[model samples]
Target: MNLALTVLNITAPVFLLAAVGFAWVKLGFEYRVEFVTRMAMTLSVPCLIFVALMRIEAEPEALAALSLAALSAYGIVMIACFALVKVMRLDVQTFLAPLIFGNTGNLGLPLALFAFGEVGLGYAVVVFAVMAMLSFTIGIWIVAGRGSLKRVIQEPLVAATLLGGVFLWQGWQTPEFLTNTIDLIGQMAIPLMLITLGVAVARLETKAMALAGFLSLIKVVICVGAAWLAATFFGLEPVAAAVLIVQVATPVAVTSYLLAEKYGADAQPVAGLVVASTLLSVIALPLILAFVI
Candidate 1:
């Protein structure tokens, strides 16, 4: 109940503001939605990442869980999702790359920053980094079904992850005063992203929304189930499992919809998936958190 209320309190204003803007545009503020997405992407989201990465502390033990699971567990799920995509001969739009790759940075990051705080998030970043890189290269290949390996290689998301890894490896924590500033900016990331998301959903048609909803269920169920079994086998502690589950269980990355739209890969369904998963995550989060943490 506390968690539910917290999500409501945080999400309501963000969503309502976006809905109003969307309605205003429909009422005919067309630029308002664009403004939100741009601001969030360029300014807010990056700040959120910088702040979270600088402060988010990964313990040796928690990091161990990540290292051990990389090849065995995470690898297995990635391979399985690919196999399903191949065996079922699904549409390019329904490929596992985009649906399964997830949105750990924008949506997942803020949620972790709030729900678990600094220490708990460290482990989550591990799973996050893997999918973060793959989302552009492998995920785009799955979704686009065209050769863009070079473009994918140069994706900004990929660059950010790589830079972040270097900084992490270099142990370059931010100065105290800068940390304060970054957190304040980072706090804005979600509201702006959510507002953008709500507007994006408002743009989608009914059929698209329905398709997205169906895919959203598949993504979450597959991810959470895989993460749980892996955590169990790895003998992950409650906290370790909790971190990983959140990494997998987060809603489709808001950017997934953007990518779909850009790549002509059924954008509306992806939008629907993002919106539905986010709404349902209210219920889903606590259930997963309890089992793990």
Candidate 2:
């Protein structure tokens, strides 16, 4: 009973906030998704990553282990997803990226924060940062047929992650006033991302429900397995291991559909993925949390 309540307590706020956005859109409210996404990506999320890394209480070595574990897990997932796509004869451009990359930002971050507190948030940010770097570079390459290192370098989140690493490595702290200001900005990231996720799902149109649902199930299974392997191999501490598993097993990111639309690679299928996987997460994530937590 306590365990069930704990899982519910951790998960309910996340879905509730997303529900608010979903309801807002269903009621015909105007929520500019592009603007919110840009602000969150360019400003608030970067601040959140920087502050979390800068203020994290975990030792630098432990964070490093988690980083390597995250990278390994992503690599394993990519291979597994690619093989699945090839075997199923799905479009490499549309299916591979969505299957490999999950919604680490919108869903994973808040769950980690609620389930494991600040320390979990710290570990979650590490995985999110790793995933972001790959999504901007390799993920874009998969969808667009070309990768741009310059674009990756120009992303504010990447810069923040790098800078934050430096601060963490040197045991440096920003001035108190500056820290508070940045933390305030960082605070906007989670809600903005969650609401934006809901808004995007509401706006997306998808017809490939059966395929998307099957692939989403496969994705969760593969990702959970990969993350578990990586965490065990890297010897991640309990919280870090749990965070990695949850983050890696998160549902398809809404950005996958946006990327498909922008790159002209069958957006509808990707949209189906986003919607299907997200809806599945409503049930999947809480169960995963129950096991991990």
- Candidate with best lDDT: 2
Q: TM-scores across all candidates?
A: 0.75, 0.98
Q: Which candidate achieves the best TM-score against the true structure?
A: 2
Q: How well is each residue in 1-293 modelled by candidate 2, as lDDT tens digits?
A: 99999999999999999998999999999999989999999999999989988988998889999999999999999999999999999899989999999999999999999999988998999999899889988999999999878888899988999998899889999999999999999999999999988888999889979999999999999999999999999999999999999999999998898899899999999999999999999999999999888
User: In candidate 1, what are the lDDT values of residues 1-293, reduced to their tens digit?
Assistant: 77666655543453465566457557645656667766765666556555555555665555666646533555666776677667657665654655576666545655565566675555555666666656656677767776566865655434544555556667887788877886687678766665565566566653556655666676678788877777788888776666777777777766777777788786655666677776676567656655554
The backbone clash count of each candidate, in order, is 1, 0
- Whole-model lDDT per candidate: 0.63, 0.94
Candidate 2 global lDDT = 0.94
Q: Name model 1 segments beyond 4 Å from true.
A: 1-35, 67-74, 82-89, 146-171, 208-214, 234-237
Cα RMSD of predicted structure 2:
0.8
Off by over 4 Å in 2: none
Candidate no. 1 TM-score: 0.75
Worst 10 residues of 2 by lDDT: 145-154
